[model samples]
Target: MSETATVFNQQLAARSAGGSTDAPPPVRHVCVVGGGTAGWMTALMLATTAYGPRLKVTVLESPQVGIIGVGEGSTPWLRGFFDGLGIEESEWMPACNATYKSGITFEGWSTKPGFQRYFHPFASMLDNMTMHQFVDNVHARLEGADVHAHPDRFFVAAALARQGRGPRARPNFPFDIWYGYHFDATLLGQFLAAKALERGVQHLQRHVTQVQLNEQGDIAHLQLDGGEPLAADFFVDCTGFASLLIGKALQTPFVSYAENLFNDAAIAMPTPLGGPIESQTVSTALRHGWAWKIPLSNRHGNGYVYSSAHCSADEAETELRRHLGLLDADVPARHLKMRVGRMENQWSRNCVAVGLSQGFIEPLEATALLFVQRTAAALVEALEQGDLGPAAQQRFNDSMRTRFENTRDYIVAHYKTNSRTDTDYWRANAENMRLSESLQGVLMTWLSRKPLAAGLKAGRFGGGYPIVSWYALLAGMGIFPDPRELQPPTSHQARHRLDAVDDFVARSATNFPDHRELLAAIPPRVGDKTLQLYLW
Candidate 1:
């Protein structure tokens, strides 16, 4: 406490970054809490890094708290995630009961009731200039020219999904053809777990009973259900909404954006497969909420997301059944609770949270798994930089925050852009919806029928529609561009390109056999239909 000592300490702290007297902390061994898609994703990604030898990764999960097996529709970025995991698409696709998804069929969100059917097809199906022409044609239609006829007709995914077809990738179209998938979340977790285990990632099948922190508030160790202590250098909290380590142990604050996003309750169910599920996901808006029908190979994943403040769980469940025209006795249902927001800091101290622990937006656009992929990518990038210092952590956290905000904005844009004024929920949203600042700007440019740059405001975790994508949604939803004409592409010199496009569709119709056939070819695992667990 001497004056000289105090001055020396002050000078030392002032000389360091963040004005701290301590040296930058080093991250090596990472302890991942919970073992669903996110936990294993983090482990798998970290294990692949050269830093894996110096840094050990372990996941603590109780077989009791099972994974939330809901997320079915994903953006195209998932292909990159599978590729990063070195998973062969042919091998894993069938094991997970995945069906190719081109885009989503949006229904009942317009001002006019029966005329509400529209398609927000994938962005990769249009060239930059062609998108502008599409936008111009949309404007021409508003002026009574019938320039577009049906925008969805041009969307390869939309056309294919109408009759249940996948896409045929050809070199001529190149970047203009985009597709994703609808799959079972639990099976995906098992698939990833198997891959992680194969890659030498340790998995502990135990629930964390208590977190023991050092005097510095860093997690020194974790107490298992049976009183055994597990220790690691860094921690990842993927324990769903419980947020066991980050929120409970680290005391990280959650920043809820409920004012901007209203839906908070969902009733999820998997129905026996038999419908118009070709290669697309369907989201239909009901009176009180929205219902999603995601087609996996074996079954259809259906859910109704609604505002708890406006409707009861039973009411939402009933609405979902009514929309899909199903009987409750025929299918059981599971209800899920959610808060629409993100953690104030995704990575706090030495712990990072992914999946529901990091944030949960209602399944409107299905960004949950995308969150897992992006979070894992960011963590891997940070670790690959060699040290998880304060600078690195802050950089990673800020980028994730931006990504979450962008996602929130884009999802909000869907609600705000809707012209629906049917019920209290729709009317209220149409009247008082607030948009994120970035989306406000995007909407402005989008109103002009201009394609948005893919990586526009997203720092790292941004993945959704590309340029052609934004144009598709805007035009599909009846948003038109200014009268100023947009020039078409000059690159297609070969007249056969049009024929090639038709050929692509013709082949995609019969390509890859059927979903069930694909599943039959894969080796049986647990509840796979090939195991004779259920009747076809």
Candidate 2:
């Protein structure tokens, strides 16, 4: 390189603002309170990516406090999170007792004959060929014409799960597959903590007795129960429902989803595996709420998410026990109270809220970890922009606020459209009229048999889930005229055969190995090696 060119590049890299050559003080330390998946994930991402070697991260975790692990499932986003860190599935999956998840299957939620069960699969390569056809049929069905709109028949993930096949394809496959996973949440958190520590993130075992604030109301420092006061340039709250820093100390307002969503309590228990594990979560409708059966490599994670207002905890637990065929078994159940809402200001002052501290919209779609990853990644971007003013803070809040509300709407739609009327719980959900304008617009468009694309393009219904996802939820719930009162479509496009779609999905499944076979193929390892290998 020439001397002149080298000097020019060096000069361009120099920082200056307002005719001053000096730059602002760098963010040197980030203190994360609470240590489960959220805290460790935030620390890991920041330590490894955000500020390079210039920033140090510390996680203050209470030894006694446990995380809400009812959501043992994850969306496809987890795959990306692991990949971005250059972690391999073979290594991590075997360590966490995790298994592939093609998608979730809704059972008994809708009692309609053919819709008694429907699979809502993750996005797939073959969906491009069939998603439009599914939407076209949904439009036709809503317009008083008989059409096939069940989501299971249109996508490859559904097919994969149904055939007991893994969601990933062989090395030679041209297209990539998107699927989630079911894992032991506790093990997964420990795995992340180990990974974070290996990369220079600090782990402190201390209980926060008090949170100090500056005159500007920003978090100043933390007082530990038996340790020195700790301070950092920035703070992250992963304290779950207690919301220590973001809620109590920062005093951020919260927006509740009580009216839109009613389920608030869950009774979780573990059940032994009976058959070959399938790549799907089965959500069966119960009298009070729903029961989730998540498949793990060794044991099945079972839980009943119900409304305490509709049924007592004892009753809810009994129902869940019965659902899992554990009524006579001596298995213990862990009950959890859900604080269903989002913080009004997730990023207030110098603190950013992650995981349950920020919000929770139930685990119907298994999106708990998705929010954790998204917030951590977004926080990195906002920090990189080098602005922490009110305007910049407000912009981040607005973006997250919309995301939370949109996710809430999707979960709410599941109950509002349920076909069960056997109990007051189901009836109340079906009669729920309190809804966001965004959700109302989407449902209204579907009811009117108009294209959903219009609402999306016009920004009427905000984008939380994809347009195809909305179609799957509605169409999967059997929201249409009675099959006995149906007639064939009048339009040729609507009447076009879907034999090709069926054949394509069927053929695609061939590229994937059976779920049981795939699980067996992972190189043998002593169970949960991270726990044995990674010592704080």
Candidate 3:
């Protein structure tokens, strides 16, 4: 293994070890409200990460509230999250009905011929050569040169998905490939709650009736529905959209993203796993918005995310049913309202907002849990540094604001450059002038055929998406010159393709196993007491 990867692996394996004991932490007791994936994730991270020994973590789960059993998609950061917690894939995958996800395949977003669908794959070691060529072709096509620029041909992840392959490489394979997962979110939350309990985190079940604040306008305590008041030195609000602590108690201002992102609601319906499992999510464009088909090990998760301003609940469900070919199927669909925005301050005096309390940018890119992990990790770093004052809080707030805006810009870009004008929803998105300066720069750079790397700086613009993602997304949507006004490529590889990218990706894919066989071998871990499920 390479020295960097070796060191990274070691650090990730040792991530749960407590911090130095030389100095005392500011807060000794921490209480996390709510108990779904967000709450348990926060509680587990606090109970295991730095200052863990010095901290007393308590999770207050409401007995009256039930968990939303919606399936979820993820980015590769989730791998690091489980790794940091010292949890193995075998322990959680089967327990959560999980499936490996290489990337997302977008379908019917464009009206242009041969551009109706494209695959956006995760970057891997094999893309070192093909990605440069893909970028060159994108630039060449920008100047009206005929070239193959579809990203699916350049990355190995798409090939893996196409061949129904999982991401786990053989022991002899020297390189690591990044991957995500599609799983039952509620089951994962239950598993995480058990893991947190194993690590000395207290779990209490009660309904929070009200959030009480101190004289200084900070959260003082929480009053339970039928129990005594509970107080803690610090608070974490994971109360989904209710925002019990940070929103109600502290009254932090909210910053809306309605202008940038228009989707305000969603309808989720899970159907039985119909056939052999594929390792990619399929996102198809609909009239009002987009629909997602995420394949899990046990079933298929289908949903439509649309704007209520242009479409109603029934209208969205009907469109989704038509898309899924289940117009009259006996499947029940659950409707949900989305608050598409972020809080002005994620952290306010002695309390931090995590998960939905922090804010939501929608589920387009599956960044909901990612931001939750980010907030928890940032809290860990701040507490490890022993800085809990106003200055530290402002720094945390400012940093998170930039991250949210950057991620929002990426999602907004997906809507802005869309070629679909079939409905008023898409037409308005195309004509929408509300854009961040950074987004404007990215679009201008693509238009001018400048190196996208120049526009997307390393850290500032690439919140979770790298420069290659911007290239893939823009090029995937057919945001380039028409093929008719094109010339043959003078590039050497395009002429005489000795050792082609396709061959390389195909060869690399051999190192991985079949998706179905791999998942089938994982004996169900849901019944295992080590990671017990929460019986509601």
Candidate 4:
């Protein structure tokens, strides 16, 4: 046998004999490479979980490497992460220039242009009703009843967003709305790092010069520049696109989603808050791709994601500036190249890749941080399941793969269903973009019927976007079947439901505080106990 294979066998034999090894060391220490939003988030979650006291987590970050701080929009699941970490909104919102995000508003995606718009609200699309009720409402609309209104009108969150209002402070109406945040990513990373440190996570400022692998091809140690080699039982690659530990050292293969999702680059910049902070993220479809306008407390995070194959960087930047009415403004636009795919295995051997290191599928839906958060949460679950063996690794990889592909399919659906053919980019995306088999099935199913909760109960990931999200996108893009196809409801029932929704929207708009006013009302700082009680 070869020397390496023989050594590996000898080590296994010694481990089996328990001469110097015991229970495979129990994953006592974890080393994280490259600290950013992903790095700090992983460290903080792992260091604060039930297993925190048993594991020692250390972060190796270099000051030279800069961060891409343009990921400001987030989904509602972020609130769960914050609450689980015992972090109150008042603690991080001010520090990160955050503003409440009710949901995303899509504009000009249909062929009939005149700035057509729709909202994908964070609230459940349907009230406490069954699919039969939804089908009846659609049929009633077909029978000359004025039961038709935009889907957002039924959601209190969307209604508040329309009125430039934030959440209400009603004691009895706690579950009436849902919200997330738009915050500076760099500031969020710094905030999470401080929390992790306070929870006993070690922070190191050093660059990883080389990664050393064991005989069995697992990460054994990481060599730092002008320092000793750092050893750990497990490693997390938060090294962004470089993917030092998982991609380079562990040799995990990457699977590209370029064919299904075409936008591969973005030019981002922050502008001064031009108006009152809007409670929703505005994603306007542009000629080449789309532009995101995320309103924060102090500034607007703006970016144009476009296909590099269709438009040159100069042209894209010009179009973005023109759209923003900053034709001659001297703001610097930072260009970013996106790798539109995920690694074949997020957890290979003893290394787990997080955030941009694992994969990226553009920022169309603000999915980068969601992926990071899910991966970190999955890692904790895997670690808690005894030793980090092959079974745990396989399960983690499968779960992460499901999350990434599910997100990719959702983003691809946006381009595939868009009816705008004004530009070559849109035409190509609508005609030539490849669809995954799963998404193809979904589209086919929706053509015959509306998406039902039972139809989407088996989503690959645990906490993925729900069926309501699919309904919003499909109905908003004008892809649903004729209302005549569904079962009909009595005229009295249809009128009652429609009037109820209108009444709810009117009351919500009247009661909620203006977006800016609510933000200003929040105390600059509050103790944890007070903030918890206030939010809870």
Which candidate wins on TM-score? 3
Task: Let me know the TM-score candidate 1 reaches against the reference structure.
Answer: 0.81
User: TM-score, each model?
Assistant: 0.81, 0.91, 0.92, 0.87
| Model 2, runs deviating above 4 Å | 1-25, 491-494, 522-536
Candidate 1, 248-324: lDDT as tens digits: 89998999978867888889987788754467778888877788888787788889889988889988888888777
Candidate ranking under lDDT, highest first, comes to 2, 3, 4, 1
lDDT of 2 by residue, 1-536 (tens): 21222222233343222221244324778899998888888888776543455677899998778787667999877876775665778878989899999899999999888888988877765677777788888878877787788888888888888888887776556655677899988888889999999989999998888999999888889998875799999999999999999999988998898886888999889988878788999999999999999989999999999999999999999898888778899999999999998999899989999999999998899988888888887776566567778898898899889888888888999998898989999999999999889888888877777878777766778467777678888899988877887787887637657897888888888998888888877533222211111100
Model 2 is weakest, by summed lDDT over 10 consecutive residues, at 527-536
Clashing pairs in 4: none
Which runs of model 3 end up more than 4 angstroms from their true locations? Answer: 1-20, 458-464, 491-499, 522-536
Put down candidate 4 lDDT per residue, 340-403, tens digits, no spaces: 8999999888888999999998887888887887788777656655657888788778888888
Question: Candidate 4: misplaced stretches above 4 Å?
Answer: 1-25, 113-115, 124-126, 129-149, 458-463, 480-497, 523-536
Better of 1 and 3 by TM-score: 3
Instruction: lDDT for model 3, please.
Output: 0.81
Name the regions of candidate 1 deviating beyond 4 angstroms.
1-26, 52-54, 113-115, 125-129, 139-146, 170-176, 275-277, 444-465, 480-536
lDDT of each: 0.68, 0.82, 0.81, 0.75
Q: Which clashing pairs does model 3 show?
A: none
What is the overall TM-score of model 3 with all chains considered together? 0.92
Report the Cα RMSD per candidate.
11.1, 7.6, 5.7, 8.4
lDDT of 2 at 112: 88
